[model samples]
Target: MTESAFRCLACGDGHSVAVHKAVADYFLPTGIRVDYVRCAACGMVQQYPVPTDVGPFYAAYPVHARKSLLQEVTRRILLSPVYYDVASLRRDQLLLDYGCGDGWFLDRAKRRVSAAYGYEPTAMQASRVAERVGVQVFHDVAALRAPLAGRVDVITMHFVLEHLTDLSGTFALLADLLKPGGTLHAVIPNLDNVEYRGFGSRWHGFDAPRHICFPNADQLKPVLDPLGLRLASDRFVPFPNTLAASLSILFTGRYRLLPFLAFLPLAIVWARLYPRGTRALTFVKHEN
Candidate 1:
């Protein structure tokens, strides 16, 4: 068998070799096989032979659904600090939720800032979100930047960066959009998480095809630090979604809810004991 080769998207390092095999896409169960690679140089994990046509998979994405009251409350408790951090950065400045799927975060942020905007790649969802939120939901960077009229004070890419294909170019665009002294908040899958260790290729974070890159703090910091984006805080966050996805892979080999319910308590305890699977990182753009 010939060993496949890949470069680390986060660090641009060669010598990234396959460490896991035949990982299936947890979301779109197409029976397509892919290898997961870990860069020896920077320790970033990514799927090899990146899926070229992901449009069909995303057309049925479930993020557009409204959250239940309990789910919303739980998110507020666990993630309010993340929003507060954005609000604290500067008052009366625009806040942009990059990859704002359905405008969930932007709807909440509109209350904190004078204006809130969002950028989502899905045109249909972006249009729906713009109508629902009564704020701009742009489908492209140019459309997003034009309305901002100036650099944004804060931007967030919650669980969005991993889905991106171009790490350096994306970060550069983000840096350019940020005002001097502005902040960028991102939450990405932690490759060091217990779930990945326990579940291996089936780990929910893999999300194969869809999640192009997985970078732990060590792997990610070096990529952004040189861009003048200084780390302000780094902390692990608990995501029930990952737990649910893991359980689905374990039992039925698909995303379902019964496993999530059965494993909710264990997931909470796991997060309390080992909160290294997913991380919330805040970075500040250096002032000129």
Candidate 2:
């Protein structure tokens, strides 16, 4: 691994050591090589030498992608079963979906809660949710001050944490927004899982430069500790959808196979055995 000067994204208190080198998928044509690193002080992991072209990375997300039929199937099969179990959601609770691309989850969440809203930095994406789902979608955290302060019961970040450039600041803000005893449900790739271990640099979850930091529970603890959030419970979902896709890329360097086929048997196995610590995870804040 090539060495580069780096600091922890969360605590900013570590010497970052180079872990691996890989090409990024976010800025496609550029094909920039990024050096992945692990923080010595806090154990937080991330990529160094990120490209200046950061705006295009998130802008590429298609508005309403979640509303598509395939995404709907995956959402039901992958997300609802593992992360969105109804027991955690209660009536009269206010729910917020951070980085809620097109408000699909926001729409579904409204069914179980008194109010549901979404926050997306992308204007075009947020507008699509506003027009299609009819749920309130704010441009950023600042915009939600009036409606969200001390009111949200549960905050959900589905597949969104991996893309953030400000990990600690975001969670700190989340702590302030949540009501006492509020739950923060986040689903991101676990860097310490078996799949990630076996695949090494080729893991599909890497998603290259776009995935700025991939942390396990140990690495994540330091980031969440200051916010008074604790890991109430954690589970892993080893759905093959992403594993198959990553393996395909490792072998052929192209992902042309149908997305459903990639996840079918894996989803079945995931449904049966219910692997925890790879595909999905959840956490709740401590009411101090």
The prediction achieving the highest lDDT against the true structure is 1
Compared with the true structure, what per-residue lDDT tens digits does model 2 show for residues 45-126? 7877534466755444443465669768766675665455666688888888898876767777777888888888768778
Best by TM-score: 1
lDDT of each: 0.75, 0.70
Q: Tell me the tens digit of each residue's lDDT in model 1 across 1-288.
A: 233446678777767666887776777655666777778788778866555676755655777766789877876765564343544644578788888876767877787787788888878888999998888888886665555644788888988988887788788778878887888889888877667888887778777767888876567776677777888888876665676668777888777767766776777676666677788888898853
In model 2, the clashing pairs are 236-275, 236-276, 236-277
